[model samples]
Target: MKHHCNRHWTASVLICAALAACGGSAEEERAFVASGGPDTPGASPAVAGAPVYRALSTAPLAEVSLAPSDVDFPNPERGFYRFATDPARITATSLDYVVADGQRLVYTPADLSAYRTRDLPSSYLTKLNTGFAHLRKQGLKAVVRFAYNYPSSEADYLNAQDATLSRVKRHIAQLQPVLQANADVIALVQGGFIGAWGEWHTSSNKLTSPANKIAVRDALLQAVPASRQIHLRYPRDLATWYPVPPTVAQLLAPSPTAAARIGQHNDCFLASPDDVGTYWSASPAESAALRTYAQQASAVTGTGGETCAPPVAAQARMACEDILREGAAYHMTYLNRDYYAGFFAQWQAGGCMAEVSRKLGYRMQLQAVAHSAVAAPGGLLAWRVSLSNEGWARPMNARGLALYLARSDNTTVALPLPGTDLRQLGPRESLQWSGEVPLPATLPPGSYRVFLGAPDASQALSTMPAYALRFANADTAITGVQWDAQSGRLALGTTLQVP
Candidate 1:
């Protein structure tokens, strides 16, 4: 009871437009592959041929910040510059990049550092703000982290000095304007500014003390708006304050507080027993408690980090399977591509790289879509959409889902779906959504192709496809209408008849 169409590669939007205009008498549907290939490598066969579903192909998806980020210090040894001062390297394989802030802040006196804590000079602020604009121009978002110093040796780590509480607070206060101005391009901000390299360890200051940590955390909370989350270096850091996870009742009510806004990042992820100082526990019982707290807390908040040098038995202990399993358990949202190259190479050789990359963050795939075969203009169209999240993490931001009606004449109308909040969709979770869409009376009478779009809630980015959510579905083309490349909306692979 299924028909497959041959896949062809053409950049023309007219082809999609033509597909959108096709209307037939048969009350049937055909599923076609957009990428002309099997699902993303390692996808289980169970979901195959499950209606017009999208399969993540062998391509790097955007918007999800992975490894080898865009921002780094000017390393003479590595032949790298501090920031992207020249043209961005636009490669087919690259996605979003990580911008680790404060790398220019040396581990010396204020005059020795390129940036001073007393005040973020106007020139420095302008340069910092330009990075976001550059990313926007390049069709990318930044995974941001800030640190005042990078320790080169154990002696430096032991002797490192951190900025005063007043100075740290002042720096944050100064950066508020830039943060607010470029919030759109910033994916998430890591809680930095403590210890060496901002990992919140080996600090000359007492930032690690429970009371001081709370004060600093509160400052970060107030500095960044509630819309974005501030991730901490350790799970115990957050558990010290927001120890208990949000109850189901509280989550159902959807009450979000600043305390709940804190998330986790394991810098030495999967590198050792207890992940190299990430979790400091003496007994198995205590370790279980910390892990439980982190898993529960991360269910609602974001978690992401990178793996350090694994032990000699890394292949046996830190295999791809273990990494994926742990990533799922921790709800990890991002990873550092620049580090742990050898481990990544091992995964590639072991035939697990594609699966790991495809499911890195939020991998949402359409399972089945049920809808009316025919509907009059300005009439009711009931739809039931089933989606599966096969990724390691859920969407941590507020996103809007809507039905896109692409007419034969290249005109499009977007209708928002009520009660479709993507934040509730978690990894390995199946979402069954049903809604009645009242077609706009102003809609023209013609055959239309129905499409699903997860657009940004921000007006500035709602129309930009780079910021839109790309579903795991395969057939994204609409043959009957010119495709909006800027939005990357997915066609439902079926047409609606209107007489």
Candidate 2:
């Protein structure tokens, strides 16, 4: 699912790309798929099989009995690396799965909880505002690649019979106003890496075509102030991405070459029973499953393609191996062969969510600050926050705004009362507020998840995410906060507990 990168792909290259989709569709899904994939010959049949993907609680969350330690990164290195993950394995996880390319994300309760529960080390979040934050500091603006996660495919994009241009036009029409509003944060549109969450495929639902790619990219380019430029980077794979410094004709070409792509982009974490690829020339079962998932994705996105049966582990490898060989000039990476390191390490029967977090770099994060000496016991914790509305629009209608506060006991508490919530802040109009919470007289002696938004509170376009507070030595709590330049302020908000 590599979005409309315009990367060059021979029919054979596209055929073999089945394995490379991140999340292969995580990112062919820009953030998931390394670069992207292409349609393949149909699969043999459907194999009915499944994995224990932690099913979501149908009813409301009845308060999970989480470990006292949550949200704080167990490792300091993870945060530093996730933003700039290795390109090799990054594409292996479905091309750009870890972090989709054109997708814009606001923290959700699930994400916040996962971080807290896993005790994500300082690595994934900000130990200090460096790297990406530094990029912001350097005046390099960022634009969210707001692509919908549907299973459309290139087939639809290129559907000459269908009035797809109208649909695309409507999408651009809808986005134009929003883009104009958040003009500050938005430098240019990278178009969507849409389809199957932007996986560059034409089967199942996520589909796009050379013509459609031109339309989307043109839309993005047209929206920006010509002074700024756009490039579809992020979850890119050398073999699959559109080469940089493209020719004007190449840029205009519906089918461009991605074979010359270079550099680090994305290919997030892949721990799955779910693998996207068509193991053609193999068994019916393997072919069937890939077909089904593609269809499932297709049904959602309106792209059309084939379906097959479920694949076995070897089949998964077979499907992936088709495109990940040196001789083939197709390269890919997986967690490992057999996946003992990926699944067995976490879900080895009764490993629990924490175990999954462990392999996920969750456990790599340090535990809650159990024994830090609060330097100034009497100093009230205060923070400075800046909300830079540099995005394409005033996204937050202020539906839900609250700082999710957790303690060392993994106990969740919401901390929003009357008179909280930011209204519409135009482009550069950001909001900065300071709130206070008293530290418990006796620290419960655990970690903390101090958040800004409420459960599933993703609507708010808050630039910074609610983060875990590390009581390094009492008097000090560290969080992965963001500094908003447009607002000319530092975004900070977190509660404290002294254990």
Candidate 3:
């Protein structure tokens, strides 16, 4: 059985700690709802040089050229330690204020546009540089929706589809050179409006005939180079096949029982109660009814009983999800969460993110999750550290965590601190360590070297567009550094274990 990922909200980390680690909103206000979307009345779309309700896909990126900030981490451990991750690409978010752990100030539609069009304060850029530098030292990549026409309703984008298309073409022309120029700012764009909140699909956008859907997807797939990545909204259903094996007739009749062609299915199997149970597991009656429905639907389409029964619309949102998931996957495109209308229309600052965190029983950060997938922090054997590397390219430049620990001998091991780094982290290569030190035993542990470097070498910096300056992974230093006390190493948590 497919198990649903545990849906819980992670509690917010203390802001007191984040205050120093995190930077202020790029401007007096955030430009757009970085997430959430659907419908809006009176919203106009982008026109040539026209200021739309939100910024377009083509916005200048905040140049991460500033000094690194030093995080004053606590050494003695007692309470649960905490630190905040920096915003990777704070282009012009429009996330309605989401009061997270302490307080999360997102952007408004107007503010998002302003951030893009207005000037960047020297101070803000300085602080941002501090964060990016720290993350770079650790070698990680940052993923953020720094550029987009997000938080705006799909209705407007779609209504303005002709305009939006032209706008994208223009944006693409500009982007090609900029992307070509920068090796650090990996920009992401979706082909057009997608998902419940623009995630990918679930509503009217999901209504396309398979053939049409494929056509639209193919065009998007062809737009960018094999090198640069384009982000897609999730519940992606561009190219998914059924789970059922080939028809029993084929299995029984042929020595060469090749798997049925993609999207090709046999409705004859639905005729048998046992076969139906084996396939979809519905009751005999449900099976028979599905078989009959498939036969009729197939006859209407002339595709030989388009057996959508097994891929029931009620349970199988496959036909729709494929547009995002498989389409992007096949093209090696990155997939962002399905930002949908349901989310945007109903989003309340503290309520929505908190609800999602609580539903999952934990807080979630898109960039952080991806980074943590590789290396997570170890609890204070008990020490906290703040590391900042201000270079460009690092570890695929993912953002998650960066920390360090000393061995009884005097060697220092780096750690990818939790919540401290995300997308912007790779650029910062910085980390602020926090938490009370605790050790299971007083005995001397082996000298260790820990630090957030890059994701494994399987990934290459050049593979993706050079968005930022990639950095070399941290070097192992201070082997056998002495520790102060006894300790039990606890697994770092992206999410806390809950009841």
**How many Å off is the CA of 24 in candidate 1?**
29
Tens-digit lDDT string for candidate 2 (1-499)? 0111112222233223333432243333211111212332111122245211111111111111112233322221111111222111112232232234222211110012122113334442332122233322222223234333332443444431212444545555544544454443332333344443333443222235556655655665555433233433222221123323233232222342221111111222121133333223256675454334332221111110111122344433222222122101111111111222333333344434232222221121111211111211221122222333321122211222344445556575444422323223332344444322223333344445454332222222233322211211111234434332332212233334433
lDDT for model 2, on a 0 to 1 scale?
A: 0.28
- Per-residue CA lDDT of model 3 for 280-378, tens digit only, reads 433656544444433222211111111123323243322323222222212111111222222222334323432221111011111111111111122
- The segments of candidate 2 whose C-alpha lies over 4 angstroms from its true place after superposition are 1-163, 179-199, 203-207, 218-275, 278-310, 313-355, 358-499
Please tell me which predicted candidate would have the highest lDDT against the true structure: 1
lDDT value, residue 361 of candidate 1: 64
Candidate ranking (lDDT, best to worst):
1, 2, 3
Global lDDT of each candidate:
0.58, 0.28, 0.26
lDDT of 1: 0.58
TM-score of each: 0.73, 0.27, 0.27
